[model samples]
Target: MDVVRSKDGTRIAYERRGSGPVVILVGGGLDDGSENEPLAAELARHFTTYNYARRGRGESGDTAPYALQREIEDIDALIGEAGRSSRLFGASSGGALALEAAASGLAVDSVAVYEVPYMADDAMVRHWAEYVDQLTVLLADGRHADAVELFMRLAGSSEEDVSGARSSSFWPGLEVLAPTLAYDAACLGDGQPPVGRLARITQPVLVATGGGPDPHLEGLRPSFFDEAADTIAAALPNAERRTIDGETHVADPQSFAAVLEHFFTSSGDFRQVSL
Candidate 1:
């Protein structure tokens, strides 16, 4: 892994694979760059892939008091290190970060994202406060396990699914990263999509979601999944929507990469999509 210094002088760690135009993969909550290696490898043939650890996870250094702009600068630092304005693909909460980066006017070539967890109404937002409150208390008290469960609920995980995950040995890693959950909450901007800001994104963008008919999810309507994706796509000035039938939150990299390749390879323009 290589390191780049953020504007704040924090060391951001990243690994580059293959060769061609640079493409950076941003991982979602509780994940570092390692989780996106599958997708990075799939994209490597067509583009050089940079899989980097987000701040507070893996090898990246986290400065005191995480702020939204600091995270954006992390992406900017990677873009500078990549030696060009690169295409970025962020999954889940990381998608929210990528959108903010593009909207921040980082010299991005294109942006692609998967299921950014946008609320279609204020109902989710109302609960977001309580969720964050409880999560903050849990983390402050060092109850990492309970904090993880609260976060799972906020992410719409059912009790059964939460129990199952807790039983798994990998659950502790999530517990370790519990504090960073608040960072994702902050990036989401009060628990809804930032319509006005997203509208300012001038680069060609693709917003994608799982098109599963019955994927056995809990806490929200199944239809809401596609609705959230559509909401984000509608907000972006130059964005297209794509659905991968039968794919859910944990998407198959090979299948997801095809959609990404198609979107990124096409000669899409802000004027073409926005107008």
Candidate 2:
């Protein structure tokens, strides 16, 4: 893992691989950078990929009294190492971090984001604050497994699904990474989409949703993911949106990479459906 020091002097660990234009892959909630290795390999054939552990997880060192700007600085540090004007591809909440960075006036050339679930409603807002509070306390108390379980439940994992995950061998490993869940929540901002801030990003943005239409719903209506993709696309001045068929919120990396490649290597113009 290569080391880059954030402005606060936190040691951010990342793997640098392949060659060409630089691209940073940021993973979502409760994950270390390893999960991005596959995506990195696929994109590595084209771009030099910097797959980094967002601080507080994996090999990255964390500073105390976490703040959201620190995470942006971490990304900024990586961008500095990668020529200071490279594309970024972030998944889930990591996408939120990348967006926040671009909005904060970072030198990001472009950003391709998958499933940044910004909580944009009153009902979601009411419960979201409480969820963050509970998650923070759980991590503070070292209840890693409980924290992971809570996150899964909040993400709509069924009881059977949660139970099956616990019985699996991977559950324990995931529990070890569970403390970073709060970091993801914080990355999403203080429980709202920075609509104003996001609009300030003049760089080209690709906001996309995953998953095909529900087989039960007969593909007749838009899903929540589609709504989110549309809302973000509408808010951004230079943004395009798409929904990748058959890839859900968890995301399928190869499909996502294809979209990123197209967006990154284009003529700085994109098309999107008008709402």
Candidate 3:
């Protein structure tokens, strides 16, 4: 893994592959470079892929008093390391971070975000914070299973689906990453203010939703994925929105790769196309 030092001197880790224009894949939650290796490999055929571990994971350094800006700096350092002017693909919370970085003027050439859970409204944000707190307490009490349950519940997953995931091997790993849930929540804010700050992001942007997946909670208002995509598209000068039909919050790589290929290879003036 190649290493770059963030502004705070934290050593960030990333894997560079493929050989055309550079594209960085930033995963959400506890994901490191390895989790996205397959997607990176697929994209490698067309672009130089830089798959990186966010701070506090893999080869990266972790300092106390974590601030959201530090995360942005981490991406900034990686973009610089990749020689600037690279395309970016960020999923979940990573999507939110990527959008913020682009808006902050980090020189992203093109960008695509899949289901960034921005609480584009106030009620959603409050409920999200409550869920974060509930999950935190569950984790503290050694209730990893319950923590996952709470998370899926907050995310609007059905009871049966949550129960099924509990038996899956991925559940344990998610538990380990549960502590960082608050970080994602914090970045999203209380859903009141629109992600207006991101309006300045000029990079050709694609805001996407997984049409296959339902809202995490039952009776939850409008879909978070739609909310996020619309919020971003409305803000950016050059932006489009797409929904990956038959794909949910947890999507197959092939479907995602197809959507990505279209966005990255688009010609003309950044037309909004739904795949």
Q: Model 3: how far is 75 from its true place, Å?
A: 0.9
Model 3 spans with C-alpha error above 4 angstroms: 135-148, 214-222
- C-alpha positional error of residue 119 in candidate 2 after TM-score superposition, expressed in Å: 1.8
Query: After superposing candidate 2, which stretches have Cα over 4 Å from the reference?
Result: 213-222, 273-275
79-155: candidate 3 lDDT, tens digit per residue: 78878688889887788877877777787888888888777766777787787778668766878667657767766
What is the C-alpha lDDT profile of model 1 across 168-226, one tens digit per residue?
A: 99898888888888888888878788989999997889887776643335666776757
Q: Which portions of model 1 miss their true places by more than 4 Å?
A: 213-216, 268-275
lDDT of 2 by residue, 1-275 (tens): 88999999999999999999999988998788877888898889899999999998889999988888999999999989987588988887999999998899988889988877677676767677888889889988999888988887767676777888899998988997887787888887666778899899988898887666533233223465566677788888898887677876655668767777777888656777321
TM-scores of the models, in the order given: 0.94, 0.92, 0.86
Candidate 1 residue 24 Cα shift, in angstroms, is 1.0
Q: What is the C-alpha lDDT of each candidate?
A: 0.85, 0.82, 0.76
Q: Quick one: best lDDT, which candidate?
A: 1
Where is the poorest 10-residue window by lDDT in model 1? 266-275
